[model samples]
Target: SQQGEEDPQALSIQEGENATMNCSYKTSINNLQWYRQNSGRGLVHLILIRSNEREKHSGRLRVTLDTSKKSSSLLITASRAADTASYFCATDTTQGGSEKLVFGKGTKLTVNP
Candidate 1:
């Protein structure tokens, strides 16, 4: 399968803390994307790092990719209560014109005030 699996099915943290999640895939990929879903709302794209990239950061979010090992990690620093939601990692196969993304089960993050 081209899909990845993320560790820690659920996480709980206090406001202002940081959270980290790890994902591992079974096959080579073209790119990996991280998404955040709030409650019943649609998923919002957080970041996308290609297989060639090592690490990328966005504000309070940090993502690391290791293509050789087929693994990735996501870190959210200074998490707030509003950050409570589900985080998902999606993998895009390397084949050109393939826009399909296989998503992981997801990590449910709960931040307490």
Candidate 2:
């Protein structure tokens, strides 16, 4: 959980606005994935962008991965109240000679109608 760091730990935006969250990592990764957790539910997969791919989009979500900078960003356009949740960026990274999926603390987003 320490391998990745996310900025703007909390964000509030009006419905239909765009919410952008950024994440930075410490080590090399293969596939960077974004997830959304709503309150008590488990993590829900949002998008997965490979290191070779610069950008990927799914529905209103757009994800960008930059291996060079060791960073990634998740953008939600036309945001709705349903989008209110904690978004986290996870990466498969090597640690202590073993590779594991590590997730950032996450950015809690609140979309108001």
Q: Using Cα atoms with residue i matched to residue i, what is each candidate's TM-score against the true structure?
A: 0.93, 0.94
Q: Give me the runs in candidate 2 sitting further than 4 Å from their true place.
A: 94-98
TM-score of 2: 0.94
Error of 1 at 8 (Å): 0.7
Those runs of model 1 whose alpha carbons end farther than 4 Å from true positions after fitting are 94-97
Q: Write the per-residue lDDT of candidate 1 for residues 46-109, one digit (tens) a residue.
A: 9999989999999999999999899999999999999999999999885566667999989999
Could you tell me how far off, in angstroms, the CA of residue 26 lies in candidate 2 after the best superposition?
0.7
Q: Residue by residue across 3-108, what tens digits does model 2's lDDT show?
A: 7888899999999999999999988897899999999999999898988999999999999888999999999999999999999999987678887889999999
Best candidate, TM-score = 2
Lowest summed lDDT window (length 10), candidate 1: 92-101
Residue 36, model 2: Cα distance from true site in angstroms: 0.3
In model 2, what lDDT does residue 53 have? Answer: 98
Q: Which residue pairs in candidate 1 collide?
A: none
Clashes of each: 0, 0
